[model samples]
Target: MSNMLSNGISGLNAAQVALSTVSNNIANAGTTGYSRQSVQQVESIAPSNGKYTIGSGVDVVGVQRAYSQYLTGALWSSNSSLQAATTASGLTTTLNSLLSNSGNLQSSLDTFYGGFSSVASSPGSSAARQALLGNASSLATVYNTLGQQLSQQRTQVNSQIGDAVASINTVSQQIATLNGQITVASINGTPNDLLDQRDTLVQQLTGLTGASAVTEGNGSISIYTSAGQTLVSGTQSYALSTKSNPYDPTTTDVVDSAGNDITSQLSGGSLGALINYRDTTLVAAQNQLGQSAVALADSVNQQQAQGLDLNGKQGQAIFSVGSPGVLPSSSNSSGGATVAASVTDVSQLTSSDYVLRYTGAGTGTNGWSLATTGGQSVSLTANADGSLSGAGLTFNTSGTAQVGDSYEIQPTRDAASTLAVSLTDPNGVAAAAALTATATKTNTGTGVAGAVSVTDANNANLLAGAKITFGAGNSYSITDGKGNTTSGTYAAGQPISADGWSLSLSGTPASGDSFSVAANTNGLNDSTNALALAGLADVGILNGGKTSIVQSYANLTTQIGTAGSQANADLTTQTSLYNQALGNQQSLSGVNLNEEAANLVKFQQAYQASAQVISTAQSIFSSLITAIQA
Candidate 1:
């Protein structure tokens, strides 16, 4: 009877523990990181005679959680991916909106060229010149505004990066604190609630930095970045930090607690998206915009220089652009050369950055080389003036350079931000050609003269006013103002070029028929340069003559739009993946309230039955005692 009572008591204890566990699971079912737990039951050891043994009911061995390490890890990984895609998509959408907005670069460019056409129609009209100036100012303002907004976006990203680092530190410290608690508690048995808290913190860290968790034997898990840098180990947590780049102060470096740079190794989280967007997409867009600004300004300025303004003076620069940005490496020696860069060929300029490194002291086939960030090197060619030229840039060195010295060259990155209309006065607009062509009065040929055009603006500098004499059998001769003459073969439709001026003869010309091209002295109302300016809208003057300015800007908008679309698609896919992973984890570890309610009734019935067994045992013992006394 005593043994039976003891067995009943043990059963009652086990059932009560199980009921408590079920109630706890039900209470925490809706909690964000809580896992449902249940008591593990073990049969108690039985006392036995040699031939027969009796059962001893049951004992509670431990409380075990419904946890799958694989599922939890998959969830964390998916969460990181989803967050990165989301961050990138939001930013790209903003960029696309700005690019596609009304009154943007494309609109401004159209207005600018329209103003040029207006001036072409009325070259000597002050109203037309003033309108052109206004349009030019509007164009410059557009570039400036876009540049400022991009800078603002970069500032926002920088602030967010700082916030992410702070979040990482806070979460890592919490995880380390929980690690200590778990390590101590798990010496007896793993504490279910503490494990939940720790895992939640680890997941938060992963969202920020894409960190991974490694379970240790003592129920504490170690945290690391995807690159294997320890974030939290045992009871000690390492922190993440940011440092200002010495060469470019506006840029920052992400580092670990030991000051090891890990910026490139960061991926698959919001931090990774921020860094990638800032470095690649943002920088590329800025450079492309600047490239367009530089090319447009330089080409127009050069053409303007080839023409004469209304005042009969040479045309001045119509726009001002910032020079190439040169940043010497912080590690360069003190005696390294002072390098300056200038654009040599606008057609060859790229929106990419290059590094110029001085390998050693040599001339023709030797010293310096230019390379992209990917490490593909280009050989440098030296000009007669001892300067080096390559990739549309001329590098002039004022002093000797060390062997390992390097300079970062950003050819057009600052152009948009610093672009402005330099020609403020309406009278400063150059709307006339510097030279004109006319058929000689005494010419007896069937040849008719078309308008003399400046085919090569730079080549026009060689002009000293020349006369062309047509000969039979497709031939022509030129006589300069100095009376020196040269001869060349010509076709009726082919251009006759001499002293930088070019003109084509239409129809057949008899031998000895003459034409002349001379400096324009009566160009007060001339519209040749204005016409040329208007023609810029259709000319392939950018991207090595592969795209016009308008086309280039349109292409930029298209690129931004495409990138935005891709990012949106990726965000959708990643979000679905994360949701699926979360659901799978929940299915394995989540608590069901209905299940807990049924457990409550079963445990209550067992408790009652065990209590009745004790009551019966007491009744039997009391009766025996009474009978013995009688």
Candidate 2:
């Protein structure tokens, strides 16, 4: 009876414990990060009475949590990828819409270029000229608006990056604290709740920085960044900091605890995605737009310079744009070294940023090396006056610079934002060429001169004009305004350029053939320049004359659209994968109320049976004591 009572008591204790465990699981079923738990039990043994060993009822040891390290790690990784894709997708979509939707660059460009026809058809009409100017102003406004919006997006993303860093710091500190608490609690019993809290914090941290975590032997987790920098270890956690970039102050950099820049290493989370999008796609798109603006303005201005306006005067610049920007790095020496850049050839320009580093002393390629942001090196040319020229730009360096000093050269980054129509008066639109060519009646054979295109607007005798006379063997002699003659043998289909103008001579010409080049007296009635300006819409003026201004802008729009589409698709796939991972992890660790309810009934029945056993043992002992007394 004593053995029976002891066994019953042990059974009762085990049953009660099992019921309590089920109740706890039911209570926390809706809790996030809660792991399902069960009471661990085993059969007990008692001292044997000579013959066979007697078995006790049961024993309650501990409660165990249903969790798997593999599942949880998979979930964390998927979440990080999902967050990165989400951020990148949003940014690219917004940029694509800005370039492709209605009221976009292409739409505004169409209206602007279409106005050229109106002005060309009626060069002297004030209404037509004013309409063209209106369109020009509208085009400039679009460029400015687009540039400003892109800058605003960058500012917003920068703020978001700062916010993410702060959140990461907070999460890391909490995780460190929990790690210590969990380690200490494990000495007494399983700290299931504390362990869940720590894992939740780790998940949050991973989303921000794509950090990885490892469980230690002492029941604590160690967290590390994607770049393998330690974020948390035991009770100690290192912090991350943000700093301004030396090359561009507006840009930001992520630094480790020891002040090492880790911006490039954080390539796995939402923060990384934002930084990449801002630096690559956003910057490239903005620069491409500026390239078109610069090329368009330069080409039109050059053509305008070679013509006369409605008042029959030399044409002035039609548009003004931002000049090349040269930024000395903040880390540059205090030697006051300065570099100023200007665009020298629009056709040779590219939508890329360059870094100019001083190496020693050589004028062109000798003293400095020029490389694009993508690490491509460009050949540099020596100029007479301590200037360097490359990639359609001329750089004038002054003052003193240390051997490692560098400057960020942006030839067209801000051009779009600063583009504007410089001429306010309708008569300022140059509509006719300054020089006209005519064939002399005495000429025989089929020889004719095409329209004149000016090579140098500032030529001393540009307006004074000249005369060309053909001789034997297709030879030609040019006489300038002062009657200074130069002889040259003409090449078939080649332009005979002199007095700052170029003209092509076609058809066979007999000896003694002559043509006179004189100033145009057509006034506002002449539409020669207007016709040329209108035809500029089809001329390849950018990218080494491989693409027109409008085509370049279109290419930019297409590239962004394609990138955005791909980003969105990636986000969709990542989201699906994340969902699957989360579901799998949850199925392994999540509590089910229905299951706990069944466990409650089972434990209740066991408790009742154990109580009955104890009662029976007490009654039998009482009866035996009574019998002995009788």
Candidate 3:
């Protein structure tokens, strides 16, 4: 009977233990990192014929908690990716805005080029020239502004990197402290909440540098970089420093005790992305801008030299080829090397033939003269190959020309045509007519019989609106509004007229001089100039309208747009993968409220049964005592 009672008590105790396990699970249902626990029961040892044997009554063997190592590892890995993606996406979005189509850089370029185009269409208009200067100034202002912004972003990233490095150090220190606590708890068989805290710290570290954590046997974790560099081991923690690279000061890279560069080894996380953008992406974009600027300046200057202005000056360079920071100065000695304008075709030259005259007399002359004793003249011929060639010329050569000694090429023609000019005197004479005139006749075959004639009926209107045509077989005609024609075989360096406008062909006319009919007579007030300036289309900037400043600006916009789109796509894909990983981890480790509630009921019933068993034993013992007394 005693054995039976004892057996009953054991059964009750077993139920009570199970109830306690269930209750503990329910109580910790809302706790983070708390795995649900369950009681495991086994049969107790029994005695039979003085030998021990398995008992029928149940006993609590062990308490089992739900945990999966694989799930935990997946969670940590995903957390690293998630942190990195978020950081990279946020930074790229801001950078994209700074370099986008709506950015100030592109706008400034448009305004600057538009101003030049405006000047080209209305060469005689001072208002247009002033507008051109204003646009140039604005463009410079915008470039400086954008450059400063880029500098500021660089500084901001540097500061952020420093902060992140500090955060990483702090996290490493905290993890080391937690590591010691975890090791002590594990040794004492105590609860490992501190270990869980260490895990949380590791997750935070991952966000900063994409570090990974490995839990050791003693419950301490070993933290390492994604590339396997030890960050923390046992109770020791290594510090990280943010320093400028020796080779590239603009870039910030991580360093350890040995001062080895670790930037390339770093992958993922906010710090990695910041460094990557600063060193690679942002730097590359800036280099692209530099290339575009050089190409733009070169192309525009080439085209500008080809076109003729109101002053009858063939296209002089509109932009300097040197660094943008430098300004045009009168001191030729200090100007470094002057980039000579390249002429691709003789048609690019204006009809004006210029003679380089000695501008300085002896050592004290203030006025220019054609004396060769002071300085020799240079004769420039506009060749059909878009190049200017002159004989007996020395630039920057001492004793050849002094400061303030003028070398001027005065184009003789007011006519709009592609022509070549050759200098007669290889050693240019001052203020001398450098080109000789020749005449050819088709109708009379006489020396001066078919000479080109001029009719300046509206000579003032000549500069205003005039057209000259060179026909086949060396025949040319100048026609006025009244259908009057001056027909002759056009001679090189000869003067002709139409509608009172005096036109001089001072150079060898090329096939490119064919006149195109003027569509309208709005003159300086024409909207065509404005439209061309606005980059609506190419307007005679390049041969066959092949290239324009507007096109360069568009290309820059496209490049930035493409880079931004790629960055966004990468961010999105990484985020999705990270979320999926997190979901998988949650399935294995996360708490279920319904399961906890069910456990609560089970534990409550077991506790009640244990109490009833004790009560029944007490009643039986009391009844036995009463019977003995009776």
Best by lDDT: 2
lDDT of 3: 0.53
Q: Candidate 2, residues 313-394: lDDT per residue as tens digits?
A: 8788878998988888888899767889999988889999999989877553768889997789998988888688999999
Winner by lDDT between candidate 3 and candidate 2? 2
The positional error of residue 513 in candidate 1, measured at the CA in angstroms, is 5.0
Best by TM-score: 2
Could you report the Cα RMSD, in angstroms, for every candidate shown? 2.8, 2.1, 15.9
TM-scores for all candidates? 0.92, 0.95, 0.61
lDDT of 3 by residue, 1-630 (tens): 465567667777877777666666667667765666666778776678566654546687676666566776666677667776676667667767776423476677667666656655554567766666566555555544444555667778888888988998899999998888777766655444565567667767887887777778777788888666788999999888877753335556788645666877887677877777776565555533443444444444443332233333323444342221111123334433332322222222222223333345342222223222124543444346433354221222124344443333222111111111221221110111111123332222322212122232213333233344565666767554445566767776565544432345454554324332222333334333233334433533322334454564466557657767777787788778877866676566555778767766776676676567667877889999999999
Candidate ranking under TM-score, highest first, comes to 2, 1, 3
Scored by Cα lDDT, where does model 2 land?
A: 0.86
lDDT of each: 0.84, 0.86, 0.53
Of 1 and 2, the candidate ahead on lDDT is 2
In the range 1-630, model 1's lDDT, one tens digit per residue, is 888888889888988898889889988988999998988999888868889998878889999999999999999899899889999999998887666553488888999989988988988899988989899999998898887777778778888888888898899999999999988888898699999998788778778878788988777788888778998898999999998754566777689988888888888788989888888888888888898998889888877866778887667888999999888988899977898999878888888888888888664334788987557676677899988888788998878788888888889877888999999888778888877788878877778877666656565344478888877776778888888799998765788877666787688777888888887776678888888888888888777788888888888888888888999999999999999999999998999888889998998899889888888888998999999999
Model 1: CA > 4 A from native: 363-366, 444-450, 455-464, 468-499, 506-514
Candidate achieving higher TM-score, 1 or 3: 1
How do all the candidates rank in terms of lDDT, highest first? 2, 1, 3
Clash number for each model: 0, 0, 22
